[model samples]
Target: MDNETTTTYRKIIHIDMDAFYASVEQRDNPELRGKPLVVGGPPEGRGGVVATASYEARKFGIRSAMPSKKALQLCPHALFVRPRFAVYKEVSQKIREIFSRYTDLIEPLSLDEAYLDVTDDKLNVGSAIEIAKQIKQAIKDELQLTASAGVSVNKFVAKIASDINKPDGLKFIGPSAIEAFMEQLPVEKFHGVGKVTADKMKKMGLHTGADLKKLTQDELTGRFGKVGKFYYQIVRGVDERAVQPHRETKSMGAEDTFAYDLTTVEEMNDELDKIAQAVYNRLLKYNLKGRTITLKIKYHDFRQITRNQSFPFPVGDLETIGNTAKQLLLASGIDDKRIRLLGISLSNFGEAAVKVKGDEVSEQLKLF
Candidate 1:
C-alpha cells in the first residue's frame, strides 16, 4: 500500500523469440518466410522430432516435437528442414550482445529466453515496456527475426505476459494491474506450479487465479512443501527474487496440465503421450539428451509427487521416453488417487548441447 512496498518491486523483462529455429530458417531462405516451414529433422528421418515450426506449419497441426512421421501425416506438404544450430547460436549471440548494451543483469534461461533486470540500469531507459520495444526492434533489425516481450514489476508475471501474445508481440503488467492479472490466470499456467501442482489444486476445487488467491500460505505450503511458498507469493504477485545473471542452467525440460484428471492407468498412459511430446520439443530446442527421466504427478487433494528413473544410455527417442515415464509413474503406485496433472522432465545432463555449448566453452573454443 505504501510507496516503499511498491518501490521494493524490481522491473523485469522476459524476452522469447518467436518460433526461434523456424524463424531462422525463414530468415535465411527467402522462400520459407511466408510458407509453412518445419525446422526440425527430415520427415523420413528415423527418430526425428520437430524442433520448431512456422506459423504456417502450425495451421496443419505440425507442431514442435511431433514426430517427423506424424507431422507428415498432419501436413505432408509442409516443408521439412534440419536444425541449423550454428546459425541460430550466432543469432543468439548477436541478440545477447544487444541485451548487454542495455544491462548486465541478464539471466538467460536458454538461447531463446532470458530475463533482464533493468530497474537500476546505467542505460536510463524510461519505461520497462519501452525498453522491451526497443530491444525487440533491435533484434528484428539486427538478427532478422521476431521476438515477443513481457514487462512487469517482477519475473513471474513478466514471463507469463511474454507468452500472452506471441511472435512479435509485447505485453505489460503494471503494478496497478497485478492483482487483477493474477486473479484471472489459470492455476495450471502458474510458472512453478507445473502440471502436478495444478492437478492437485483443481481437485481441491481451485482452478483460476481468484481461487488461488483465497488459499492461505499455510494451507498451500502444507500441501506443496517448499513450492507452496512460490504459489503463495505468485498468486498475490509478490515475487521478490532478483534477476540473477550468470545463472547456472543445469538442464532444460517441459510439462503441461491436463483439462481432466486421470483415474486409470489407461488414462495416465494417454497423458504420458502428451507429456512426451512436450519434453521432446524442448529437447530438440536445447539439443539436449539426458540420462534421467522424471514423472511428476498431482493428486486429488493438492498433494504433489515425483518419480524418476535413470538410463545407462541417453534418451532421445519418443516411444522409449513415453514408456519410461509411464513405468515410473505406475511404479510408484500413484494411480490409487485421482490425478489432476502429469509432467515429464529429462534431466541429469551430461554435457552442453551437442550443437551449442555454453558461452564460456564457446570462448574457449575461440581461443583454441
Candidate 2:
C-alpha cells in the first residue's frame, strides 16, 4: 500500500465495562463479592428480566435480557438486586472522563461500552495498544472496576476484538491481521448479526466470514437487503466509517415485557399509559419532539408486529403518545390475542432524522 493508503487506517479502540451493573453491585457490597450476583428486577411476582449478571453468575448461563426467573432457575442460590441506574450513570461519566484524557474522538455505544479514535491522540500516545493498556489500568486503579479493550485499525474489528476476551481483557488486531481474523469469525460473532440472521445464514451454509465472502456483493444484497452490502465490505475488513462523536437522535422510545400476558383491553391500555410516560420522560430529558409514533407488540407465542401513525406536526405530550398507541393497538385487532410485550416510540424529528449514536432509547429500555 502507498503512504496515503497506509495513513488512511485509523487507530481505534473499543472499551467495554465488565458486567457493568452487576460488577458495580458487587464492588459496593462486600458480602456480594465472589458470589453469583444478578442486577435487575426481583425474580418474584411476574418475574423481571436480568439487566446484567456477575461473572460468577455467568458460569450458570445467566445473561442480560434473560428472565430473572430463568436466571434463578439456572442458579437457585444466585442473589438478585435491582438495577441502580443513577449510580451506573455516575460511574459511566467517570469512565468517559478517563477516555477524554487520551482522545476527544470518542463514540459511546452505551453506558458500558465506547469506541475511541486515537490516531492523533491528545496525549501523543503513538501506540494504540499502549493507550488501551493505560486506559484499562486507569479505570482499574481509579474506579476499582475492570474493562476490556480491543485495539485495531477500524471500528468494526476493534469492537469485535473487545469481546473476544471478557471481564478485564484486551485484544489487539492490526491491519495486517484483520482479514484473517474476520474470516475465522463465526457469522454470529459479527457485531450486528442477531440470532435470526445468524440462523438464516447458517441455513444457507454461510457460517463464517470466509463463507460470506464467497458470494459477490450483488448476491449478498439480493439475499439480505442493503445490510448485505455492509456485510460484504465488513467481511473484507474495509470499514471506512469514521468514529462519529456527535450522532443525532433519530428516535427515542421505551418498551416493556409484562410479567403475564394481558387479555383485556383495559390492561393493555394501562400498560401503554405507563410505557408512554417513560417515553415522554425521555423526550423531555432530551428536549425532543417527533411527528411519528410507533407501537410494537409481541404476542405470548413470541410473534411480533408493529403499527405506526404520523402527523404533520411534532407532538410530545403524554396523552397523544398513550392514546395514539392505544388506537394503534386497537386497530391492530388485539382481540382474542394474548399480548406479552408493548412498546412506544417517537421519531421523524424534523431535520434530525439521522443515524443515532449509542444505544437507541427502545433498546436501552426494552427490558422495562
Q: Pick the candidate with the highest TM-score.
A: 2
Alpha-carbon RMSD, each predicted model: 11.2, 3.1
Q: For candidate 1, report its TM-score.
A: 0.67
Candidate 1: pairs in clash: none
Q: What's the lDDT for candidate 2?
A: 0.90
Question: Could you tell me how far off, in angstroms, the CA of residue 359 lies in candidate 1 after the best superposition?
Answer: 4.2
- lDDT (tens digit, per residue) of candidate 1 on 293-337: 888777757588888888887786788789998888878886367
Q: Model 2, 28-146: lDDT tens per residue?
A: 99899999999887788778889999999999999998989999999999999977877888898899999999998989888889999999999997999999999999999999999
| RMSD score of candidate 2 (Å) | 3.1
Model 1 off-target regions past 4 Å?
1-6, 249-368
How do the predictions measure up, each by TM-score?
0.67, 0.87
Off by over 4 Å in 2: 1-6, 203-205, 222-225, 262-270, 299-303, 326-338, 352-364
Name the 10 consecutive residues with the lowest summed lDDT in model 2. Answer: 355-364
